[model samples]
Target chain A: MNPPLSRRDVLRRLGFVAGMWWAARAEARDIPGDSVYQLRAQLTDQDGRSFELSSLRGQAVLVSMFYSSCEQVCPMIFETIRLTLLALPVADRERVRVMMISFDPARDSVAVLKATAEAHQCDARWALLRAEDAEVRRIAAVLGVQYRRLASGEFNHSSAIELLDTEGRIAARTGTLGAADPGFVKAVRKALSRQA
Target chain B: MALEIVRRATRIVVCAAAACGTAMAADFITVPGGRFASVLPQGPVPTVSVPVEVAAFAMRATPVTAGEFLAFVRAHPEWQRGRAPAIFADRRYLVDWRSPVLLADGGAADRPVINVSWFAARAYCESERARLPTWLEWEYTAAADETRRDARADPQWRRRILSWYERPATTSPPRVGGAPNVFGVSDLHGVVWEWVDDFNALFIAGDSRVQGDPDTAKFCGAGALSVIDRDSYAVLMRIALLSSLSAADTTGSLGFRCVRPGGERP
Candidate 1:
């Protein structure tokens, strides 16, 4: 807003400005709960309750998004999670929780999530939670879940297993939704190791 | 007195042995493997209408060998070897053909072939003037074993199949089990899924009889009685299972055994 700065003044400020831009660009996503970290968002879930992204504060949360009706990738994803969990020694399984969030609010109700859970025969440790439309989208955006519905009422979404450490910052993510085998397993293992 | 006694004993023994052999042949198929249900598909045998004529001979034992399927593949060039179609792989690549078909101990030609497709198989059968045995014909043979105590039934069969499933992946050749059926068929199971004609012809809708049930209404339809010999608990599996995959499909699992028509069995 001021008159054009003198050549000396502009030159004098360039390094400082350049340094601040670099710092911002290279900023590490905060490991939440740290003083340097700030909670950026929150959402209300189906139970009329709210799940603050910050709630996954301390444990490594592997959040997976899926709808009950998926035919192609859901089963593989479920099995991958199963193998990953089973690959963990029983002791390690106790520390980790695989949170499966349902993305299709129109049809994926609580009952549907439970049915899907049963269909896969997942054990009690796996939590299948369904959120309302707004909450699903908001939380999905918060977690960077990329998803779109196909014409068949099925979803063509990224089958990514997102790793959030106890502090609730994204630790790592990998695997296309269609990976047939334990690609997600590799990602989860890498993330857990990173956390350690 | 010694010669008279020997002659008398020999006649008795010969008569008894012949009777035993006859009884055994009448009860040819062996149900050595699963406690799982057998299918009693009774649909129209478009190819072989005369039921129980043993229109097709069952495999003496399951075929979990590469040699067996290789014969089928070699005979049928039209069947795309690696990319067997989706209709064959259950709409997914469940069959990993490249994984391994050879057994740990090596090969057995007599073993039934696994990891083959209906398309490849149909060609093989056609070349020989024999087609894949319909589900009904297979059931007819299996029932003989079921009734005569010639076959191991129930709990034992279940264990046998499960055991095959648990075998090391590297141990490709399916182990042989279950005595041969009357027609000299071997290892019908405890190896891989056998192919049958008219698989999806009779669908098992959950509430088939109900208004909401699928069109055929459960396992009891016009086609139901045709496919099933009786409503045995295990038979439902064959009737209900829809494994009609296309030729381009390849699976680590799944294979087939060849059958010759009654008049055709060599």
Candidate 2:
């Protein structure tokens, strides 16, 4: 019952099939051995755009975890990361991106995340993401960030800035907060330079 | 001679069938949860035993065996020794195996699978639609003995568990057939060190004294958690071992089992 295929029709069908194949291949490439991209967690950014953690590949990332309700150390975390980025050269800064994941995902919805992003003066280069409670725990485990929720609706957590290379490998980590550690900044610069 | 040959063939067929049955069935026992006092104190005080309210759940009757893990890897190649990503497992993962997918000659199929990273164990549990028990759940279930539900308060019970820890780590572990505890669960102690979901949360602080320093900024909220019941050496030893490990780190004697939510069948 099928019609005889013309050359134009045949080429059109072949192109469509090839396009689909390419798309699937690109989506399913093998992740690197040392990359944290292997973790499967769904995240929604401050802009309410949903994405996987693996989608941040191909760009060096400065990652950390914090909660919106945290008044003392959390704000310092944002400031500390901001200063760390400022320490880098302008060109290198443009090459490196930043991601802040919330450990208190139940309270930090997209609207709250958007407000926090604005308060921190976060530009497009930065992403404030929220995930479910279990996914948050998994992300914290992968990053070696420790946290525990208290009875008072507050959280006690270890603060660290992890530098992830383009492939999502943790190249360097520093627990020094409230100020930028020069050595960590240098590592970030080196990771960015390596990407180029 | 023909009769002897037939008998040998029959024995082989029976053994193969039994192995197949075990591979298909992983026994799980229901644990009725309740208000339990844990050796680890909640909040900052060390004087009171933190009352933890645990919900009912089902736990594997025994630690996952080498045969089960091998079959799991065969079904999901991504978790095999060399094939798994380094971020999820260290180089020592399944190093004792004969190859990436095969067990060595002396590695018994029923022995608890060891040298597995937490991530690998978690993935295996996820494949079964289950998960590693939280530290509280494991601690609560482990507090029981064959006759009594809360045998942890008995000195003899504590001594028995501590004796297992005193044994040299170099010795080969026995098979996963330890006597069942009060909950009808086996191998909760005296077998292998199992991974809990919240191992990192156990010892987030290196020491309680460090909380006063500016470096304490590393930890938010109520600084580092201090020990409540310092006399529970067996539980403390477990916490120390777990605290020293990263998720990707594996050990020669470390293994894990899965737990399902209450009333869920597996």
Candidate 3:
């Protein structure tokens, strides 16, 4: 049998329960109608950490879709994103998160994602994620990216980087690559400002 | 143990009585696949168009009906008219339904369900252990008529399909179970526009004449060139309409059916 609880013990248990309740409430709160987080997508990151896409809520994010194998344009995609980050102010850059979800999840294992992350020097603020094929399509659909697998096993895809506000609504999108789109950077700054 | 037995018995009774509300099991007919020349080629254009090989698969005999969708929404309440998240569906989703789970009166139950977003259609298909047919598969299946498998070359057949597109949408769509094609599939034409699984992937250049524009670089790695099969305007129009739509955008005239794996060549 368990011992009768003291007043301090009772208070401690109540605090624990209240904390749990608060956390659950925060998770259960209605996501904004337009938020992409409503998809409930499951993703595994570069480090093999699995999490729901909604967990990235409450932050400004730069989202794009790509497959790691493409030697020509995909590399430029990473560089363009890096250049975009460089154009941001230090504070805003630190505040922003980058998400690159892979279109070719059949080939992009967690190890490949980690290798790509290390090669690209993706920092803690960056998440290179891989999801199943169907989920990948849904993610690409929401982000307005289009891709088709060719007979040569190569992917023909449109490149568009989407900026998301704290609530996961697309704030801005640009197809510009190989250099930063100043307008897109300005929009990112605006999103972060709204968060402040 | 006794409680578990009671619960199992109750579920069986509900299903047996049809009180649980489920659509009749979809009729999946096997479609023998082969090499076919699609209007939208898989290869980059200006290069000689190569025929894409389609694998054998099973497809539903008709578009999912209002009664079927009513049963789907009833089983999965989250996909009901108002309750589905805005990210997956739009305000117009299932607007024709009298309520979340009820089909409107006057034989609307047999009519093909429309105003469904791609995401909702995909979810409904997944619940049935199936998926939306790919564009190539749908095109191949629709190419058949009552007698010949590839009837696109027949002028009269093309005219019939084109005429359906020419007609204005009625207040209510016609029911499923139209006369079957050679493959035993129905409602491929003279019905609501269906959603293909890779509808978003059918991207074509907005204007092929835009030379030396940096914006054209938006598409990477052998972007789609001029459509070679210009004679297939009906098919081209379908591609245009599909590519223009976002996944969440539902329309009164859009619906979908599902497909599953079928016999292998071996």
Tens digit of per-residue lDDT, candidate 2, span B113-211: 998998999888888788999888999899999987789779999889999988887645689978999899999998899999988777634565654
What lDDT tens digits, residue by residue, belong to model 2 across residues A1-196? 9999999999999999999999878766666788889898899999999978878788889999999999878998899999999999888877778899998888999999999999999999899999998788788888988777765667778888999987888999988888889999999988887785
The model with the greater DockQ, 1 or 3, is 3
Q: What is the lDDT of residue B191 in candidate 2?
A: 89
- Predicted complexes: DockQ each: 0.01, 0.59, 0.60
| Per-residue lDDT of candidate 1, residues B1-266 (tens digit) | 99999999999778756643211111223223322223432224211223223333434334434554544454443343433433222333324344333322344453444455454555455544445565655555455443342343555655544565566654354455566645455555445566664332333324323323322211111212222223343444444443323332334445554455443332
RMSD (Å) per prediction:
23.1, 5.8, 4.4
Q: Once superposed on the true structure, which residue ranges of model 1 sit more than 4 Å away at CA?
A: A1-196, B1-64, B72-77, B80-112, B144-173, B208-234, B243-250
Residues B1-266 of candidate 3: C-alpha lDDT, one tens digit per residue:
99999999999877856743356667888999898988776754423468887999999999999888888888899899888888889999988878887787869988989999999999988887889999999999999999988998988998999999999989788989999999999999998899999998888766655423324357666665445577887888898999889999899899999999773111
Report, to 2 decimal places, the DockQ of model 3.
Answer: 0.60
Per-candidate TM-score, first chain only?
A: 0.65, 0.90, 0.91
Cand. 1 Cα-lDDT: 0.49
RMSD of 3: 4.4
